[model samples]
Target: MHLELHIKSGSRSGEVIRLNEVGSQLEPSSWVKENEVIELLLRAPAKFQSATLNLYDHRVAATYVDFDENHTNFVWKPQRQKNRSLECLFINYFGLAELSVELEDEEESKVIKNFAPLEVFASKLNAQNVEDMLSYLATLGDEQLHSLFQTTKHGAGFKEGSTSPNGSLERLEHTIDKLSFLFQSLFSKPITKLLPEHRVLQASGEEDLDDSALGWLLDNLSVVEEVDDIDRAHFEFNDRMYKAHSVQVPVLKESSNLYENQVVHGFIVTLLNEADKQLTNYNRTGSLKSAFSEEMPEGYSSFFTQVNRFKKELLGNQIERCVRAIDRLKFLKHSLDKAIPVTNYILDRPILTQKAEAQQSYRGVFIEYINWFERSCPDWSVYQNLLAIKSIPTLFESYTYYRIGESLNNILNPTKKGQKPIGSLMHDIDGNEISLIREPTYWMPKNSRSNESLYINSEGKVLKSGKVKPRSSQHKYSHRCPDVVIEVRKENRPSKLIVLDAKYTYPTLAFSKYLPECTMKYVHGIHNRSNNKNLVCSMTIVHPMGDADESLQSFHSLDYSIEGSMPVSPSLQALGLQLGLSQDSDRLGETLKLLLKQAGVAIPENLQLPLFIS
Candidate 1:
């Protein structure tokens, strides 16, 4: 099989880049800026009359124009996709063939390809991102992106791959938008519960009371103090006077009324308030009202009108009545007669578990918010088997994670091996243990003791408990899930952290500014819950740029005073560990060794291999 990749747009438009035979390693003949259009022309061997071409790792079949009996052409545009190279595959009666092209930033002038071996494609996340980004983002159109963005940010687990133009933030905004709509729908007709309340009332007359009230009157009324004169019978009891010859008296009766003070009601109330606050913050930058309508529509007042409406409903329902009743009853050391105890919803069980439309809507809203709060990304169920544009950052993260683990395995003995996606726990000769966790979500709930990290295995499932995992000090409102985290536990010392966040961009001003802020979050945001101390000792930003600034690669301290922005890329020469394109493992290991030493971790003598050993 033979292939021809040509530049269809930009400064290099109309240039034909040659392709080598299958199995040959070659650099990208040329580069194109992100989102630039390109053309792929494929020709099958003489024996084969037709051929097939697939782009985005063959997840999306490329539509081609037949040039001849054996030749075909297809146009592809890498929309809003940047950094790292993308792989293209083709097949025919001659068998399968493969080729890759690197996509560069629009501003980058250099043409050096920071290529890693194709074996890097073995990682599932790398493959999944490519398939998901391409198929779901564009071919399915904007509505799909909007849907995916909503699905990911709401209740569904976060969809892997930062495919959207704005990445996770854009997805989150989409979720908020949907939630804003949902809250409005809910508040206009809030859910209510029929609460049975007992009230003590004095019977006025036989005709003035209902059947239940009459029954209570007949059952409770009796002579209070043995009235001597039945004609003049008037008794004083509980500081209230009652006239007799069978006169009016106080009685307790139970009546059911639709009340909005149950657990589910309070939950929705809290969600509405919090959603309004978030919408306000989101509105400061982007307008929810504008997104919703050009002008205020009927029944829609403002971005947060729903919250206010619900609050207004509370006035009519008088939730305060329940509160005052409870307070009085509790103060009097009496059993609750009219007040319903407000309690939190049980998280393990489904909220409003019933088969009604309104119940389902309430439950849906509750689950969506909880999923968002938990930071669980959407699963691949929405657009599985779809084509994905290869995400350079995700690819680099996978490369760096595996490369580091590969190097560590050389120095340390494998103590424990994880299943599914296959994580590892290694121990040095000195008994110091280091564990590699990939995309582990450290749930930093307000309760520190319950704060734990769940590992997302290769199959995208959370590893069951009892497997080794990372933990962090409690966080307020949000969870932290870094791409790659290395936990180092040395003898007689607090466990230290080495966080690797892979970025696939050059050392530009924006990149520099982002690195520190991200590093600080990883450094200080995640902490040791047991000791209440910071856990991260070194936070490295792994990029793929060969011409990175020196300052980017060098370690520096930020607010927490730990090393931050230590850029590790296969392109840069760290520790003079140069071995051509394959130097990634050595370069990463040397940097990790430096961090371990700084954190007072003792690397066993034999395990600390020399730089020349590769």
Candidate 2:
């Protein structure tokens, strides 16, 4: 863990923060060192925030001049000739930390390839205090701590407490980008849930009573679960924006006529008052309407009052009046009775007075806005708020894009069409966990192992067509049969199958090797008994071994293989690779990317080891 001790009160720039002392105190599983030059990743609390940083490596080596005395009893000399430009470094005593938690048998010196760069969070600003940063880091779980280390550059020396090495800098950039994106998004999402912003906007001109811009805006407020009553939505006619809302919109029913019906009347009312807004955004932005034709409709009388009764029936739904509880929605809705809340949406769009349209795509944009808002500004995590921000945001929008053109669904509109292919979840599977997920397509013919009877979907039984019933599968073979014949799509390429039946093995080679029998069992089942041709299969003994790596080595192929999670030496990459995972291009690269992102770690290049260690 690393921390920042705030020094140089006003600005961090140009402030001299020298290493005061260097030392350490070690515990069973951890240690704290002094005079260490560590780099920290930080966000300044306020504008114009800055700090002076000091660095050290050893427990008691404070002054570089002290290092000078230790080296040759010579005074430490500044490298730069100019007095002002002088920056002296104790070259002989330079140091960097290389902490390793590794295998017991391997010499710590022999483990050269470091995996992740981790940093110690030393300190930061909060409640007017310059406190210990590592103390907070201490509270974090090992995963988060591991992630912190990932943020650092492994095998690289530090200048200050939390800085990464040059080698891993690029990777660090990518990790921070992912984290920053998540943080910004999570922040925005929770913020919107905190407020009940108004939504209905007064239009300048008349459009449709149903699908018009005014109607949609008014309708939005009605179907929303917020805006409990008309009072919350509508102010006096004297107000600048004449807003009206729908009645109680049920939780899932946005298209209800009764409550939403009032929105239609509200549209006419807003249009009548704001005649300038009556024109569609198309007409408003473009020169289309003939000025002379639209002038007062040549002695037309105001029909607004006469339509009030009919509007009331539509709003009430005289056919079958239904109302939902307001208090219920308030508890869950965070607002009133609208299915989709819109106070922020209303404030966001200035289009009622501008040239924006009430297009479905535009409305969808608003829905997405709400989604983004709710995700970014989570109440629980202030560090990762995302409220309405255009900054790096995170959402499952990539899936939406993926669904646009593929075999899934033509869900996207014209504007949504894009070239970026949707990415799939790399099912880097492990353990008996695979069997836990019920197979999707293939039938899991759950039948007694004692008998070959098979059934599907609890009813439609699949029987091997014969004059008589087949004998129990267990009768011929002592082995218990799997009730399910799971199906999964093979990689769309020429492929082979290797089956390894993992088991306990105290000795080997006495029974003429489990290899041939284990290999032939599945082949015989596929060929002789089934009488089916063109089935290609290969096999290996999946017998369990004391050494997990040894078990993996026993069954190696370009095709897929499964192994139970072992007690020790479970190599993630080896398991993935040996199991025929598409690691060369897609899986390995993506795994690295995901790990880098999740770890907040980077891989820098061209950085040399620190001095003094040799």
Candidate 3:
């Protein structure tokens, strides 16, 4: 397989360079200038091992790199330098299959003559799909949900079937058992007893009576030689022999309504039926569709088969339990009446109440599970559509924010003594103290000229006459909400501010020209009059590209000078930190370390490796 590189700078400036073989020298079809940012586009036969650009065997670096729509074309910017030649530029494809490269003096010829099997890449992508689903589910704040889908151990490498923990069969069995226990615990032990009722029925000798008062009489009469009893007198009442007894007849009675029990039984039956359906669907040979509408990615047939067997065994047990429970509940409901002694009812009420509470809690969890299954899992068609429309850049931004926050916590609060980590801990920029406030809201006066004059309180709401305003106009005013804000306060120094904004766009030369304008907006918005006492030390725009010289130049060229006031000095910078689909923890840590250092934050020597090790 061969790859082609297309280079484009400004309009009318473009060249095509083809790599027929590794170590093959290629000259640009057009004149290339030194220090000029050139857009290099290459379509790889396979996915690259890393999304970042690697040049001259890692000697030179490229910026703003990413894969195009099909994930075959790689896009990035390589800025030519005075002494560096673009002759040895090569991208390493460490995908499932390996590529052979031969390096010679000044020229290395490496050709990807053989392609890795497509299934290899497909399976890996499939696993990643599962990982993403697990991550989203974890955010729902349900431990049971997490346990069900979380395959990989935290900080440990991803291993197949890690989510199952106990083998799938055992896990499914445990879940069914839990459901059964929940259902059984909902009601107290059967307390039905025969009691006297106004209505009575004649008992014949042939009739078998068990717990009824009539049955008791017949049993006693059979043992007696004569029908002489203190309270009962027997006589023939019909053509056939019949026993007429004056004894009190017993009827089954209940203390509460059976409506709730009936509803619960119905829910259990539905769940069991659904489980069986899923089991059956998965049990079929070559059926890789999961309960979720998305088809299982290729190479997971065996895994699904195992899961199906587990579900099948589990469903069998659950079905039996469910059927038996339903029968018992029906019998109790039919035999009992809603009139019983309050004292007897109270005697069993505590235990039954506890059981009912437990049942309610479990029912709630199952309901939530059902809701999540219905709403969270997309059908195959919808899933494919979503894949086509999903924004990779947006997802990358979210992950970057989390990664940056985590890295900061490890570096600044290594001991974990603080109430909250640095990333999420919002502090009052003007306040001298170092306490962290979550979702800290600032109230700006309506009369204020700029959106900078803001107020912060413990409740984050405007106070009026010792009470919060029911409707405050302060909400209409705009306030700065930077992507990441870090406030550091030293003993005798003013509070320092570090504001960062995460941009998902590629930082091309044209885009870099706007960096100064963007940085100025961030600075003025965050460091307005409300934060006059604090020093706006640094402002940065973080992206998933290489550092553009234009961005740096633009940031440095920003003017904070005023006519009559001393010029304000602040460090403005842009960082290209790639946090892509493939998790590169080392790269993340390196980027964060550089970001913090550039922002004037000191990294403790002992905290270096610990930040990314886990």
> Which is better, 2 or 3, measured by TM-score?
3
Please report the TM-score between candidate 2 and the true structure: 0.19
User: TM per model?
Assistant: 0.32, 0.19, 0.38
lDDT per residue (tens digit) for residues 117-140 in model 3: 111112343334323432432232
Model 1 residue runs over 4 Å out of place are 1-389, 413-423, 447-450, 454-477, 509-511, 547-552, 555-581, 584-586, 612-614
Clashes of each: 13, 92, 11
Relative to the unseen true structure, what is the C-alpha lDDT of residue 161 in candidate 1, on a scale of 0 to 100? 42
lDDT of 1 by residue, 1-614 (tens): 33566665545678876665445676443322332255665543223322334332332334443445553344343333255544322110010123433322224222211222121111233233333222222322322333323221121454444232222333454544564565555544555455455455442323244566446545666623343443433444455544422333334433222232243334334344433443333223211111222333232222122222322332222234323333432332221122323443332323433532345445565665456555533233322312111234433444455555555555453332221122256665567787766666654444453434421111112222225444423424245666667777877777777777765444452245546755545665666656665567666666544433342355333322233344221111112222124354435555666665665556666545674433
Give the residue spans of candidate 3 off by over 4 A. 1-194, 197-396, 413-423, 426-478, 489-493, 509-511, 528-531, 546-569, 581-604, 610-614
Minimal lDDT window, size 10, model 2: 386-395
